[model samples]
Target: MDRSKRRFVQALGATAAMASLSVSALAARRTTWDLLIVGAGTAGLPAAIFAAGRGRHVLLVDAAPQIGGTMHLSSGQMSAAGTRLQRSQGIIDTPQEHFDDLMRISRGTIDQTIARLAVGEAAETFDWLMSVGFEPLAGHPVSGLAHEPYSKPRYYWGARGARSILEALGPLVDRGVAAGRIDLLLEHRVVELTTSRRGAVTGVAAQDAGGARRELRARNVLLTAGGYASNAAMFEKLSGIPKFVDHSYAYSQGQGLELGESVGGYVRGAEKYLANFGVILASEAQPAPLLARADFYPERRPPWEIYVNAHGRRFIREDMQSVDAREQSLRLQPLMRHWVVFDQSVAERAPPLIVDWEKEDMLAAFDSGAAYFYKADSIDALAGAAGLPPRELAATIEAYNYGVQTGNDFLGRRHLPVPLAKPPFYAIRHQGVSITSTAGLAVDGELRVIRRDGAPVDNLYAAGEILGSGATQGQAFCGGMMVTPAITFGRLLGQRL
Candidate 1:
């Protein structure tokens, strides 16, 4: 070993000795592992399984009391080209085409190397899912869902949100452990790294659930510890943006980001923070919900009326077909905040404003002023009570009425190609909210974590949301991008790295 490696080994030894001394008068013992995988979530579990299959002694540790990580809450949509299942189903696709679609949608923001690695190897990993009896939602592996449409039918989702993906992998993990190829240490949190003087990782010092410190040496370490979305302070510090809401996995506290940085891995992908549009019913002051979502994505239910701001003016092409188009338009506004303004005519004839609310609940919202409802004889009085400038709202209503009479509109809104001429007008406040962050850690094509100085930290790797959605999806959420890339990259790391 070189001088640096020797120093790292010695330092680790001393730390272990100190830990033992602090605990009791017991002698220090050493445990060695061919591969030490941190986290037992979506990415880490597969790594453990694949490494164990290679006959390597593996130690899998997680901070959570259980496994499954963020996969427990994710939508778990997957994408690929030329999957074996697709071949058998008479579907045709190529990785090259998949690569082209990602680039075209991302508009060159994604790292080409990582994108290529993921797209090129995606189908095989997807095929592996089939070998394990992984099933998809009926009518899935279609062209796309809500985001940009795919060039070919390459997207698939599990039946239940993310559980379907986890169920398929759980049996494989159990098999690995039964064969003695893998040892799992749950409720164990890695605190610090034991490194050699040359900065090579020698081992990690961790505290178990019972608060006992232990040291273990390993030849390599893989960090699949999701992201910092659940950690507000770290999320703000790393991405320069405050946590908008707490809808992500609670265990995603960004422990891996801290651990990686402590060992000389610098952060990347912070530049890709993009929030999705139309997160309904969130208050301006806090995260989480004070009210449930209004479910305004017109594709789910055709928009019955126009949406507006607090000023009661139309702000978008209400008939636009693309969710991406709508979300991107919302992102351009401040805080993604807006309001849905309609009238009594819409209230009576249009679909319910809220998904499950009945006439009674809707009336209650109006009575309590939780939602805006004004019974004014004229449009100007309605606008004033709704807190909008009377003239602007009146002019807007008049223009809308003219369109209904003339059979033509400048905005081309087909759903309510009619006027809001009625007894009362209504409005509901909303804010732009997102469950996923676009910003994430930077990785090379091989998925190795790199330092700020642009040097690869050997034997260190990261996959899944730890790398951030923004790095791969860019400013807009391309459909199937976040969950798919996460799982695809996880599979790639396990089988190859």
Candidate 2:
């Protein structure tokens, strides 16, 4: 679907939307709103609902036509200790434990005050989600999946992933709209946060689809607009890392960070540059989002083929139990890149290595002569074709085959079911990819946008990735930290602000 027309407009209730601005509302559009919530996604929607239900006239605007922002693509996994879901599952956990695990995952390089705030409030948000008909995936509330595992069963999402959370939120938003509390400005982009002469945020200046600009006023403005993922320039500038893969939602263009920074907001946590390893780049000559990726999670699927760096030496144990350890080990490799080198025997014998992919399809990729995937008759040829050192590649295979015969693997690899013995060989090159940047607008416990001096910008609040994952998940993808902190912060702001 064309994103321009995709879910662009919120279905109108009896109450008029922003485009249809009633005469009375228009006359006061520049001054009447009590709260202006920008970017109606996970955090934005909740802030709108909770604040509007409290008798505050709200203006909810999003650049995209639809309501759910990243929900369309988000895996939507979430976690909160001591929730009703955990109680029902007979899982014992606490916010303190969650906080400790999160800090351990980030190695204490996170915003402790903000982490405390989110984890303590997350259980209430989870209970509220359940009360609103948000059902969990069967046998969910499990420890973990793609990322690191929690100590107890506290992770879950609906069958539809982010759509499940969106479903639970739709009714609450509709109720607010029906009661004339929320005036949703779908397809309207908030370009700037309008502020006062003394540097206090007063409202937002937005532009609509037809290129018309409007300065709408509100007593309180939520800086929940967009993250930096979709904007390459800002992403590189703030993240200090080139976008190796373009997998973020297109709407996450960092408009919120831009607007906030245009004022007094500054970014932080850039030192936490962590990479998600094993992304098969779309182009071997030049880095791109994908061809596809090898899930390569030892917890889910043990390795059949070995992983080797550009030097053609094994870099990992291939069966590391901890996801964090694997990611850290990957960081030490050349540009965090490696190739999956295997022979015909492993290709036909071992289970498929990539998720949601078949062996033939992978072979087809190799046959296509894509630079990222290669098919060769010899180890030296495979190395030359896949950009690895020829001698090193051949020696690496010999060492591995020797280990396979002696039953004493060099790299502590127990999953050596197949060695590189067959004549026809294959190599799949992969570079690390990051979905979200670890750097973003730094804010305090109140969710107020802050400056470099640790001073808060009044009435200017931010949630979601706008705060950066480093603040929430730290350098590691702590289980469910993104969605959970986003909701918890937005909820906290709506209730107390």
In order, the Cα lDDT scores of the candidates are: 0.70, 0.80
Candidate 2 residues 277-385, lDDT tens each?
7788776433365668786887678887888998999888887788887888887787788998899998888878777889788888788776688888998888888
> Candidate 1, which segments miss by more than 4 Å at Cα?
1-30, 209-211, 237-241, 282-285, 295-300, 310-312, 353-399
lDDT by residue for model 1 (1-497), tens: 23432232221121232222323421222267777888777778778888888887777767765667877788888888899867878988898888788787777677677667777777877888778868988876788755777888999888876778777877777666656666666667888777888888776787865788878688888888888877888777765556767788887888887778887887777776666666554344555553655656667777766666555667776768776677777766655666666777777777666758775677577777663344455767766766677887777777767766776766776665457777676766666666765556667778887888778777788887778776667666767666666677766666675
> Model 1 shows how many backbone clashes?
3
Deviation from native of the Cα of residue 444 in model 1, angstroms:
1.2
TM of each candidate vs. truth = 0.86, 0.93
Task: Return the lDDT, model 1, position 106.
Answer: 71
RMSD of each: 7.6, 3.5
Per-residue error for 440 in candidate 1, Å, reads: 1.6
